[model samples]
Target: MSRTTKLATIASASAAAALALAVTATPALAWTAGNFTATLNGTMTIDAGVSASCTSSTLKGTIASDGTLSITSATVDGCGVTVTPKALPWSGKLDNGVATINGFAMDAIGCTYGGNLTGGFTGTDLPVTATFANQTVNRTSGLFCPASATITAKYDFAAS
Candidate 1:
């Protein structure tokens, strides 16, 4: 072969080798999930900021590969009270990353007496503890008294 032909052949071989390497070096898509500790921080305000205030607290829990999460014990403190009411039970459910609770009660020691409260939540959860923010609450007194008010709240969890 002529010198020019030999050089052309070498160049073609080099180009083919580079193309093969580029194809082989491509990365594959991967999905992985294991035990991990997650912390969620946000504000849980009531009535826009007139009733309650909370800071970025820690939420410790576990997450599985399938996104099935459960937290055993979580604590949140930054809760403020504005009325005197009988404290009620705090309970809720987490669905698809949303926190929904029926109610959470608080009393302001010597302000108004006992009343019933209802509220909703907005927050994020990574298959574990759900740390919510901007919870809105409405408190209504019994038939005879008929007093009502609104406030914010912050509570922890023992998710499972």
Candidate 2:
């Protein structure tokens, strides 16, 4: 074969190999009741900027046929401060790649409460931690935090 033909063949082969690698390197995602960890990150606007993070492991949850993850119950105890309201309900849509929850609850920031954890997700068995942005929350007499604040959240599902 001529040098030009050899170069073309090499280019085609390299292209094919690259394509194969791309397809094969794709990750596998699974959203189910497996070894998972939910992490909370960011700050709580109170008397001071309180750092917060809540991590839970091996939470029992369910995945619908459409890839909707229904986490029955999970506890996240890292509110930068000590308080009673620790755990919060968590739900998500694996198919749509969205983190969600139902009802109002106290959040990770010590006393100040009223924040919902929500973020985007991906396909595959808890490949990466999903981060939900901080939400606006109102204060109550219960936590002693009179002013409202915002909180961000991050969650990771343990591989199946």
- Let me know the TM-score candidate 2 reaches against the reference structure: 0.50
lDDT of 2: 0.53
lDDT of each: 0.42, 0.53
Pairs in clash, predicted candidate 1? 46-152, 71-159, 72-158, 83-108, 84-113
- Among these predictions, the greatest TM-score belongs to 2
Q: Which one is best on lDDT?
A: 2
Question: What TM-score does prediction 1 earn?
Answer: 0.35
TM-scores, each model vs. reference: 0.35, 0.50
Model 1 Cα lDDT, one tens digit per residue, 1-160: 9999999999999999999999999554221343334343355444422344544334344444344333333343565643322333333444444554444443443333223223333334323344434343443334333243344344443333
Error of 2 at 124 (Å): 4.3
| Model 1, runs deviating above 4 Å | 1-40, 48-51, 56-88, 109-133, 141-160
Q: Once model 2 is optimally superposed onto the true structure by TM-score, how far is the C-alpha of residue 138 displaced, in angstroms? A: 3.3
